[model samples]
Target: MIQTILLKQRPTGRPKISDFEFITEESDLTLKKDEMLLETVYVSVDPYLRGRMSDAKSYVDPFKINKPIYSGSIAKVIASKHNKFNEGDYVSGMLDWKTKQISNGNGLIKVDATKAPLSAYLGVLGMTGLTAYLGLTEIGQPKTGETLVVSGAAGAVGSIVGQIGKILGLNVIGIAGTDEKVNMITSEFGFDHGINYNSSTNMNAAIKKVATSGVDIYFDNVGGPISDAVLFNINKFARMIICGAISVYNNTELPQSVSVQPFLIKNSALMQGFIISNFSEKFPEAINQLATWLADGKLTYTETIVEGFENIPKAFIDLFDGKNKGKMIVRI
Candidate 1:
């Protein structure tokens, strides 16, 4: 039998397990020309999926009700009638949440398990890494000796962004929720400084204390009070890369924050929202550089892998609660 997860309903705010439905069906191993059968191995659950669950106008269309929900996943080709794919080949792409499925090979790309772990293709060697690298270099335009501040510093992209900042010779400061995360960013990821936002009453003061010269580049992952705090400490010509806003993703009403216009105007700073797909042309270059870094021990990543296909929805919902340390993946 093959099991699959479907969007049971549009979530009101934070997603619930009831919002998803699981169904089981007999396996269909038959494959047509140019089609292949894939057994799901790993699934990537990210905060951005929350935006897709909503019917609101956005970069991507909302996941249809009672339909299979899709995400970045790694799968093995068990049967293939396609010329490009073969049995035993592992591929990665945006795939449905199913134990087994058939594909016509539209967007799937073969990944070598020997080069790196299969789960990594969905993370550091995949979209997550591309996002961090492109969003930083293209928007940040970082210069050596400048101060770089990262919100959600212990997260998948933020962790990579901070490491990349250090690689570029910039002074890196990370802002995380817990003391352990604060310690991990500095101890494991090589960030120059780490601030536990939950322990710090005044984010502005905390950021200012570590970033004494002011923030030259701000990689914002959580856009709420933390972002508001960064606004006050930006240097002249500072570059602010607006990534995901996990802080306000679950809000039903429009959340309020400090107006950034005055800050940008006063400091002559640059702020831009970054979506990874916009920079598709540079993917090969970014992946090459990331792979080189990984092989050369210049880069490292973490993953919180949950077992079982049934736990997919719960794993995704956990992202809101900050349960995972780095990239969250589900292993089947």
Candidate 2:
């Protein structure tokens, strides 16, 4: 039997576990020539899944109702009819929320479990890592001695961004939702400063206090009021990378806020939004560099794992609650 989670209803605000329905069925796992049957090991629960739940237009297509939701999943080949994949080989791809699947090896990347942990392919050595690398280097164009401010600093992408900032000799300031996460960013991730956005009444002042010289690059993960605050501190020719907007992902409308275009124009700052796929052609280069850094111990990461496949939806919901320290993954 294969267990799968179906999106039972479109959510209004923060999603509830009730919005998801789990079902089990006798999956006749079969493979034709050039195909492989996979058994899921780790399921990734990311913030972007929230956008997919809505029927509205976005970078990725909305997940269909009554069908299994799909994201990055690390699986082991239980049976293979393909020459490229052998039984017991590990692979990662955009597989379903179900426990089992069949694929023709397209879009599936063979993972060397010996090089890194299986879950790393879904995180640090995977899309999240690529997102941080591409956004920071290619877009942010960070330079030594400049200030880099990253919101959702303790998250999957932001945490890595901070560490990479330090490696590049930038003054890295991270903004997280909780005190514990604030401490983790500063004490563990080598960030220059950490601000607890939840505790601070004056977010703009808090950002200014740490970033005395002004922000040279801003890696925005959670948009909304936090982003509004960061805009007040951009340096001339600064770059702002719009990564994720978890803060307003559930909003029914595009909430209005104070205009930031004036600040951008006055400072000649650039703000650009990107889907990780924009740099797909260069993924191998970034992935290899990230791996080298991880191997050399220059980079560090954390994962919050939920123990069961049935807990995938709960793990995803926890992201908005700011319950995770780094990447959130579900171990199947």
Candidate 3:
């Protein structure tokens, strides 16, 4: 029997811990041929999980009532019926939020933890890292010395986007909600400039001051006024990669409109939305590239770890409220 978190119902406002409950279930532990038993380590709580709580049509199906939630998790094989893996082999992928899990060889991939921290496979070394890579490269098409602006810039994906922009020789600017996060992005993450949107009354002026040369690329994690502000400051033929809209993820009603459409029209700019699943076939290549950068000390990542399986729901809600630093993870 494993204690797992279950979504009791859909959220009404900010998701309360009451919407989820910890319960135990006897899972299939006895492995058949080519099967394995896994012990869970870390679970990811991303902004995308908020969309899964609603019935609205989007990139994926909503999280069903009374079912165990699934996300990126790091695990160790305890018992195996397959010859390819044995006891103590570490693996990572989408696994239900249970202390122990059963699986065949299909989705699980073995890893060597000696090369990097096991938890890295859940942050910069894994799916989240890949999202930043493909989303920025294929979609943003950033160029050297070009001005790049990124929203949610201190977060998991945003942090990677800005760092990669700097690595590619672009003048990077990050927009975050807190003075602490703004400082981290500019001083720690190497962003050429930083904007604290929460403290600024005029978002347009702040963006203009930071991106004085005008933005050539924008990686938008938050939509609404922040995005509207970025749109107005973009240069001609700029590209906007709409990776997420975390600001409105919890709203049950329609969101306010942005009055910045004229900028897009005047610039003849390109803006496209993406889901990591769209590039599923090339995930390995993305992961390999991210891992190389991480191990070679060319990249950096952060995790706002909320301890205990009981804290998963709170961790997710924190993302909507801009309370997390990088990737939010819960340890079971």
lDDT of 3 by residue, 1-332 (tens): 78888989888766888889789877667778988888888889898887788764653678888998898898889998888879899998889888888888678788789988888888887777888888889988877889989999999999988888888899999999999999999888899989999999999899898788999999999898899888878999999999999888777787886655677799989899978889888888888888778777789888888898778778887888888898888887
TM-score of each: 0.98, 0.98, 0.95
Instruction: Report every candidate's CA lDDT.
Output: 0.94, 0.93, 0.86
Instruction: State the displacement of the C-alpha of residue 255, model 1, in Å, after optimal TM-score superposition.
Output: 0.9
The TM-score of candidate 3 is 0.95
Residue runs of model 2 more than 4 Å from their true location after superposition: 57-59
Looking at model 1, residue 90 earns an lDDT score of 99
Clashing pairs in 1: none
Mark the 10 consecutive residues where model 2 has the least summed lDDT. 55-64
Q: For candidate 1, lDDT tens digit of each residue in 179-294?
A: 99999999999999999999999999999999999999999999999999999999999999999899999998989999999999999999999999899999999999999999
Model 3 weakest lDDT span, ten residues long: 54-63
| Model 3 steric clash pairs | none
> What lDDT does model 2 reach?
0.93
Error of 2 at 163 (Å): 0.3
Better of 2 and 3 by lDDT: 2
